[model samples]
Target: MPHKVIFVLIDGLAWQVAHDCMGHLQGLCEAGRASLYRLNSALPSLSRPLYECLLTGVPPVDSGVVHNQITRLSTQTSLFHLARAARLTTAAASYHWISELYNRSPYLAVRDRFTDDPALPIQHGIFYHADSYPDDHLLLDGEYLRQRHDPDLLLIHSMNVDDAGHHAGYDSPQYRNAARRMDIFLSDHLPGWLDAGYQVIVTSDHGMNDDRSHGGILPEERQVPLFTLGSAFSHAPEVAVRQVELCGLAADLLGLSHDKPRNQELIRR
Candidate 1:
């Protein structure tokens, strides 16, 4: 079988904070090709921009999702598009904006409904609000999607940590507890996915500062934790950590065709 991906995206999770606070994820850390990975989000470190960069492996200008006002991605080279080209099924769970990005508001069936563009075909997409859904519920939704579609690419985005960070401040117990609990929940479930032979990619879009807010270029805001587990990571279990461009990594994980460099082939390895 080919390399499938299960992506867990924790919002506003700083690399230092995730490493310091999320001990429950230690098993996954051990399962990975490296220890705590220190990586940079796209410039501006904002959620929307970083999401676009993640999908397209391009900067703000090319992705066409420069601000919060922009909901849909116009970039043709996005992971979704390339996944379609590779004939891989893709699914996602998270905020409603994600569904809106595919021009599907109100959730009228998130399976390959992009009428405007035939290239980007989403197998399934679920929308959840940050204030309402708990971390466990989000994980359940992701699991449900995984079982339902058996998608080749799965994206699980959680806002619990970011929401907690904003409401109680980044340094508060609430924020740390949020990350810890998320780790525990995923710790229980993620192994099953790995057992099923899917490569796991755990990361955050960006970090939060002391003010409990992001969208800045501060180190705390721009840096995020990146964890690669299963066979996709070829390095040793504890290689030297280094700075990485996250968007390119994401594109590579999904086997995006146009974005591949001549020297490196990710999905095959």
Candidate 2:
């Protein structure tokens, strides 16, 4: 069994962005025999709902997190809760909304504190405010959490690149620069976990378009990249190959069973 599982959630990251900034990730894809799985987000194509889907293996309607705000859940099952039930130490550091959804005890969470929108929901956990473009300071926080806490599961959410791409357009230099910076983080900061024997899963909630506007029900907005690295998986399965279910991917990586009642055949190519 893999000692650690690290989920790296890059917000608003599209396949094109990864293709453009492929150097850092490319090596991992090659070295660890990584694979890319193209998966679609839920309808309306927002962050919160899709993230819920990724974590719980349930859709927005089932998870009761259709939008960015917190809603009453009929079944309040989360990946963190499940991990804890299995006696696994879990931690997450995300932008704002996600941290709120999974902010429970023993779960190290860091909420982003750069938002001005009051209507936006509040997230609990280990919150960290980003002061500038490249919040490289997160590296230190991530290291601290991994070394000191040594959580069995650690999730890192980077929004600087996503915010830049949304505002300045995905094709702009700002987005490219943000991607490069993210690459640096992965190349420089993440390998420590690998050295310590962690299974790293890098993915996105959904992809963005050149205009940077999502929620349009388009493939670019719905389809995102899913890459897995470490000793758990041997090969980076081929692209244009069979499509893997997003929720199933998460469940498989964590050694959990699929909890939803959907047509699992739909995702199989």
Off by over 4 Å in 2: 70-75, 104-125, 129-135, 239-248, 256-269
What would the TM-scores of all predictions be? 0.84, 0.79
* Model 2 clashing residue pairs (backbone): 33-235, 33-236, 34-236, 35-236, 109-126, 110-126, 111-127
Tell me the tens digit of each residue's lDDT in model 2 across 1-269.
33467878787777667766857887766664555556666665677777777776677776666776553332456666666666667665565456556553222333243221222222112445342434466555556667766777776777777788787876688877887788887888666777788877788776676777776677777777767677666453453422224445444556655463323222222
Writing each residue's lDDT as its tens digit, candidate 1 over 180-219 gives 8988888878668978888787888788888978887888
RMSD of each: 3.9, 6.2
Candidate 1: Cα lDDT at 93: 77
Per candidate, the number of residue pairs that clash is: 0, 7
Model 1: residue 87 alpha-carbon error in angstroms: 1.6
